[model samples]
Target: MRRPLARSWTNWLLALGLSLSGHAFAAHAYAQFGDIRYPASFTHFSYANPAAPKGGEIVLVPPTRQSNFDKYNPFTLKGSAPPSMLGMMFDTLLVGNMDESTTAYGLLASDVSVAKDRMSVTFQIHPQARFQNGDPVLASDVRHSFERLTSKQAAPQYRTYFGEVKGATVLAERSIRFDFVRPNSELPLIVGSLPVFSAKWGLQGEGPKATHKPLDQMVVDIPIASGPYRLGPVQFGKDVTYVRDPQYWAKDLNVRKGQFNFDRITYKIYKDSTAQLEAFKAGEFDYMQSFIAREWARAFTGRAFERGELIKAELPHGNAGDFQGFLFNTRRDKFQDVRVRQAIALAMDFEWLNRQLFYNAYSRVRGYFVASDFEAKGRPGPDELALLLPLRAKLPAAVFEQDVPQPPQTALDPTSGHTLRDHLRQARDLLKDAGWTYRDGALRNAKGQSLSIEFLDSSGSMGRVVTPFAKNLEKLGIQVQYKVIDFALLQKRMDVFDFDIISNRTVGSEAPGTELLERYGSRSADVEGSGNVIGLKDPAVDALLDKVVSATSRPELVTSLRALDRVLRHGHYVVPHWYGAVHRVSWRAKAFARPADLPRFYQPEKLVTTVWWSPHASAAPAAQITQPAPKAP
Candidate 1:
């Protein structure tokens, strides 16, 4: 879902509270709301320890279920690249701090300047920046990276993300400018975040015979880029290691001063979660962030734990909750009716699952933007109403008449007499009203077509979670098929929107903008490999997305999002799941040291690999560990 800003890019920056129209001068950093926390002279981020030693080989498992990897080009759509390829091997023009949500400081670029008309932005490459091959990073390299990424061979999300940028121009050897199709304030930051690489990459042979391979065809080709790490040893699909570059161009840069502390970071591949946990107990990995509450509560214990060798701890942060749920494919006829979707959603008994399996470790997710200001709460406020009024005809009356929609409550309420039986009755009634009735042995439509759902997943562990729900659906006479396939097949099917129902999680955003378009926009719904996996294609949602991106202030942005959230909830596109408040993690004790000041917003694994340092790293003449910031699960 990573893409450049387009359409409302200018308005999005304005909504961030940036006061700009013209006559903007270059600066060391750019903040969404024009409020830069760290001054230009700041040494390092507060979350990082500049004086800490760095030297360690931390072996960790992939954050998500990555059974294996097949390609080196992460930008392409065809194959799976190894974990941490996005963060470890590429350098962006700007880098964000762990504590901030929307501010980014110069990384490859020393400074950035916006055009007076707000239609373009220019950046000067850091003079000392050099690629892995020791060639200086130039404006031409930036242009090449942008063009290559936007090409058809790359993933379609890249095009949808960078669709707003008109073109890129190399103003000088070290200066490049990005022209926007519209005057978008956020366009500068979006373009600044482009992953730059050496043009020599993918080029084969020498002189005239050197043929440049298409980005997708460059599979398994080692990347040549300016970053803190280089591709290290690999056991093909079994494991991969990243080695830190001692001569990394930005080793002393302010943005990188105390980060990427590991000398060698290895990712061990395990197809099964049970095997992964067993291996971790056997000292196969240095750190692990566990998501399964059963494993965290019961299994994170052994001889290593009693001897203080393995430590299990919970880390706290103020990040937004993930929007996890069982998303229904609206593009399919079975889920087209809102009543039917709501009926299906009513079958999930979160209370029973929380009490029995989860050990009461998670909170039921209610809305798309839960635990955030953008979340829709009570009836639309005046600001939200003002935005929603114009599209009254396109919206459901429930959005304006009712409070924010809540998942079916299985807990007993003496006053309302609500329970799991009541929920099942409501589901049955809703299905009947939607032209479905129990006939023969299953719920069937007018044509005797049975209502069926295949709960598709890549992990076998999901069976425990989906079994109870499937049983509840069976009570409603709906056929439930739970299938756990391999990760690669699951990914390929997902790319083509080839599933009836699938469980997925989307990361929450603090300053959400154009990315919303790719998630729920009508144009992106048809684009294969786009984030709109639920196949939502609503004109009303599309209009709300525009309002969200074009919002002029923080209040306006919040209002627009609230309105959008209300509409999305009313649509019943997903059956909400649950989220944990604290990050549950386990690590080998006495292996790493971290700064006392914790970041306000950060993933557990990112903090572990990037900010934590080794006590004996400086002991060696040149530590060879490479730190990688893998995504949070």
Candidate 2:
């Protein structure tokens, strides 16, 4: 998952250049790797249709566990916000093209430059950039965005993401500079993705005097940021609509062109997935990105398909596969033992679950950053060894002595010897070795403490998914309890790192940067609401994370990540889950159309909101259409 890059770099990339005074070196675009598909003079993104139509509204049921939204603010950690709030209202300094994974073109900032020392990056605000209230996007606004996001008032992820940034300075009326803690290659691009909004947002406008309020208390405040849309209407906690701005400043920009096509986008909040899918069948919404394999295979049939009003398609994407599993909160004493964690993981009969529950719709998730260059496979190479060798004392011997551990395979056929029984036997052995044994009905430690687990969740809908695993744990003499609490309550619990195990995942990145620290770093392990849910605090992991963030080249980055993957795998922080081969989706056929070339790496809602348009409107319609969601990013 996309994480934060926070700290002083151990190995700063040294690119030679002269940091001359008043020597402005500007570019219209920037790439993590030095390849830009669209030149500076380009008028539109390759994936967007310049003349696509707008006007028709698209209503959707969000794929979140929360049934309703209580806030307009999307950046906070407390409450849920509508899906269209962030992308529709706020704009970032740069916008990455979907076709290419690592390139970003100017969005809010017209020109961007990096200092020769790579210690700072500068941005010149676009002359045409304007807020929804018609205020010009000033240098102060950029600084305000950075300050507020990195401050205590905003969400912890922002602070963790931009933590390495030393400070944001207003260079001029239309220019700003962001100085870094160290000169890293990806810092500029990371800073470019910062969401910029008018400082006037979340203010208490008393007559003519708008009083500034802290971001933490600005939960339900209406935002005044500039984007394609503004808050149109709301039905309390039921639904929220975003109205497209007719005079949006960046509407004609090359980076925008044919995006944000709908005149109005609405979201209907449903408490249950079954109800949500039924609503789609009844034409209450335009699209449904189904995650339940049973619902996708069985429920998406009947009248709509028979009348050619609905379409179901499995869309392919090349994005990094998202890792989802039972994330162990390592802060808990019971989970601190690696052998106990390993033993518990051995009991997930994925083969049996795949055939019985998921209709064999998933492939085993092998490792973090799976299907990417970062995933550790086969053996540790010479480059990875260089990094891993120094941390041998902090890591397990198996990391250097053997290939990374793969998930335990259970045979699908009845006659095969490799089955649940075989893996359970291995699990018993590991548990015995870890000083745990079946005693007085439950596994007890040396202190006579029985192994107890609570599968913490929100909405209680995942009981079916956890039931089998809990049953398996019961087989190993473990006390298993499952409880589904409120979403807000769960968030509160996770923030304080108070949990036994939680079903969670991270949004993976194409080129993982310092954000690796926020995920597994020692510093973030104790930080409340930090993404390091596993509470991983190994010095070897922290060191490898530092290497991954500051790597000058792709080879070095991959090597560092492999070293990290090996270490974490051996640690067994989470039970590896499964991934889908394709994004399974069901959308209304006659409503919207998309670009000829679908983006290789994208989320389902992202594709619908950004590129898809309605043919019923006056302008030219985009051709082709889309799939579902699963990727972390």
Candidate 3:
């Protein structure tokens, strides 16, 4: 049976330490500690304590998507795409919460302080923090890192994140100060998450080459980081290894005081999830994060669960936001009508799909925006509104109002099957109101144009999830053409905004920051390689995003976020899909000891690839396993 949720603060704290301890022991021989200062005894199962012995290699087999480590150059990388690579090669000023949020704590930097006006922030770098080559990390390096990232030669994604920094100056040998043109409360969090690179090493290439490069041509051989691990050996298109840094600085800082227990980590690449899962079952890989629930339920039968060989836990994912959804491209005239969007949402039978396809292991989301507990829960209190009402007095009234009402609980029930029919009727009525008519069993507009929509979906499970929705639209006298494409082509089309409707997956961060601006802001619509694949361009969203980025207090930030969420919900830009409960990962019980504080959401900071280990694994003899076929529906 699973452990019960902690009922008290003490219990929660104890549980957190215990969980972290479990992970440290299973992965590496490490020591455990109750406090930060005192040294603790090392044990074979002591993986939670930072003082633990750090030697042993762990092999990780991710469900899908291989490591893009070859493209780890500081100036050229985009998105969080380089974190896994950088996590091994370099360290950032601050790191993400294990749960994967924008709220960063100090890593290379010991602490950060923001001015009351939020225009200026100061970072106190750890004196011992040094690059892999033993050069001390200085304020100059921080300034150089920011300057290169913001320069015109950098990728657009990297430039947008640091464009808010008005100036960066070295205040002291171990300190850097950043002044923002406008008050930006989220600046520290954003900068902290960005890996700091060696100024001397990064400035050598083309003096800063900009434009995009093919994934294959990007460089990954030499990496410079101040973190606990440095890049070991990486074979392109095969595997990347991370070896522990004996002279790592900030290994004893409060934030990183109890982490990075594994001595070495190896990430093996597999093109498909089925192949990856089969490799896990045959013990070629030590762990597999399960995404297909039906397969998991069947595999963890009598012996698997009874023997404690297979572990399943419901991780409270604070950063796991709204269900993955289908986004409509408003740029297309066919999807311009709200009725068409509603009709498409209504005709789909989520009840049948969830029960049959997902084994009822997911939750349906009705809102465009989702919030974690760390995020704004609902309407802000009076104090919060006071701070926000001044900056956003002229904002849309919809921002303050909960415009999109969630479907009734009964309507959300997949077993009832009546909600879809009811919504379908409403869709039909709305279409008629929008001057669309059903004639000869087909929907037509006033211009005598047949109502047809083309949806782009990636091949495999993603395509399967979208197929039912396409059929549902057909039943409503609407034509939906499904175009299945490979992941590469799908990514390219999304980057260029070339699709009508696209089904994609997005994982939200715990601390909702400006990264979201790229997804919904007007300015981001035209930014090349941005995540705003749907091309959303609303002045209201822009204003809300600005408020979210600049709010000084937690209350003010929450209020601003809720207001922004209300607007996005009313707009109905995307039809929400499903959310998994926990990260279902299957691993060899005999291999590595699990951490006490296993992450709820896997991000660059909390990846098992950086921390897990296998005491029995060795380089002398390679184990081989055959790939398995895709799981049957």
The lDDT, on a scale of 0 to 1, for candidate 3 is 0.61
Candidate 2: worst-modelled 10 consecutive residues by lDDT: 624-633
User: How would you encode candidate 1's per-residue C-alpha lDDT over 12-53 as one tens digit per residue?
Assistant: 445445446554646788755555677778889988888766
lDDT of 1: 0.84
Each candidate: RMSD to true structure?
A: 4.5, 5.9, 8.9
Which residue pairs of candidate 1 clash?
9-184, 10-184, 10-185, 54-617, 55-617, 263-624, 263-625, 263-626, 264-625, 264-626
Ranking by TM-score: 1, 2, 3
For TM-score, candidate 1 versus 3, the one ahead is: 1
lDDT (Cα atoms) of all candidates against the true structure: 0.84, 0.81, 0.61
User: Considering every candidate listed, which one attains the maximal lDDT?
Assistant: 1
Model 1 stretches astray by more than 4 angstroms: 1-22, 205-210, 413-417, 618-633
Per-residue CA lDDT of model 2 for 105-138, tens digit only, reads 8999998887767788899999999997889999
